[model samples]
Target: MQAVDVQDYARRLMEAHGDKAVAEAAQKARALEEKGKHEDAQPWRRIEAALKEMLGPHQS
Candidate 1:
């Protein structure tokens, strides 16, 4: 639905599953995007993007 909804869902998912969840979701979204499943990945991509923006750059 809305971007806010996607962000909220992402936050909840992240809280339940931690960082791995975001990584897995992002990977899935990328795979879907490569397959031209843009519609399918829309929510995931939004969630990933929002999470990244909120978390800032990751350092290892």
Candidate 2:
């Protein structure tokens, strides 16, 4: 039997769990920033911004 490729496996995992992962990441970023963990929070903030850009603004 052949071993499964890790990147392929990760891609599948993300596809299956992407939304939850993004939401959780956003929450963690907010929590970190709120607690004065700005340095650590930078990466998450970038992720959140990118997600927001992809989502666009809500129209209602």
Candidate 3:
């Protein structure tokens, strides 16, 4: 995913899931990966990374 899309999705997810947004994004990525959907999981992985960055090292 593009950086802008990742940030946008991460922001929306954070708003929806609050503190659990990272976990939610991770779960989505893992689920797709486990199902042999690596391509599909890429965006979620990006979002997960973006969410982690947004949270910062001191947060999560």
Candidate 4:
């Protein structure tokens, strides 16, 4: 088997167990964006996006 990048593995693990975190981060991202604090919301948005991707297209 190929060696897994540790950081990537950890990220995947977080994504696997991330439903609540994803929801909260997404909510925060939306709120910040609405407030014109897009820059501040960038990381949260990225996190929400990545975790949602991990959850796949079937997720609600």
Clashes of each: 0, 0, 0, 0
Question: Residue-wise lDDT of candidate 3 within 16-58, one digit each (tens)?
Answer: 9999999999999999999999999999998998998998898
Candidate 2: RMSD to truth: 8.2
Candidate 3 Cα outliers beyond 4 Å, as residue runs: none
Where does candidate 2 have its weakest 10-residue lDDT segment?
A: 1-10
lDDT, candidates in the order shown: 0.83, 0.60, 0.93, 0.66
TM-score of each: 0.72, 0.52, 0.91, 0.57
Candidate 2 TM-score, C-alpha based: 0.52
By lDDT rank, best first, the candidates go 3, 1, 4, 2
Model 2 error, position 12 (Å)? 9.3
lDDT of 4 by residue, 1-60 (tens): 112343354376475656575677678889999999999887676776666666678835
Q: Point to the candidate with the largest lDDT.
A: 3
RMSD for each of the candidates? 2.0, 8.2, 1.7, 6.5
Angstrom error of the Cα, residue 37, model 3: value is 0.4
Clashing pairs in 1: none
Candidate order (TM-score): 3, 1, 4, 2
Weakest ten-residue segment in model 1 by summed lDDT: 16-25
Candidate 2 lDDT over 1-60, as tens digits, reads: 112343343344346667564576578778998999988886665555555555568789
- Superposed by TM-score, candidate 4 places the C-alpha of residue 16 at a distance from the truth, in angstroms, of 10
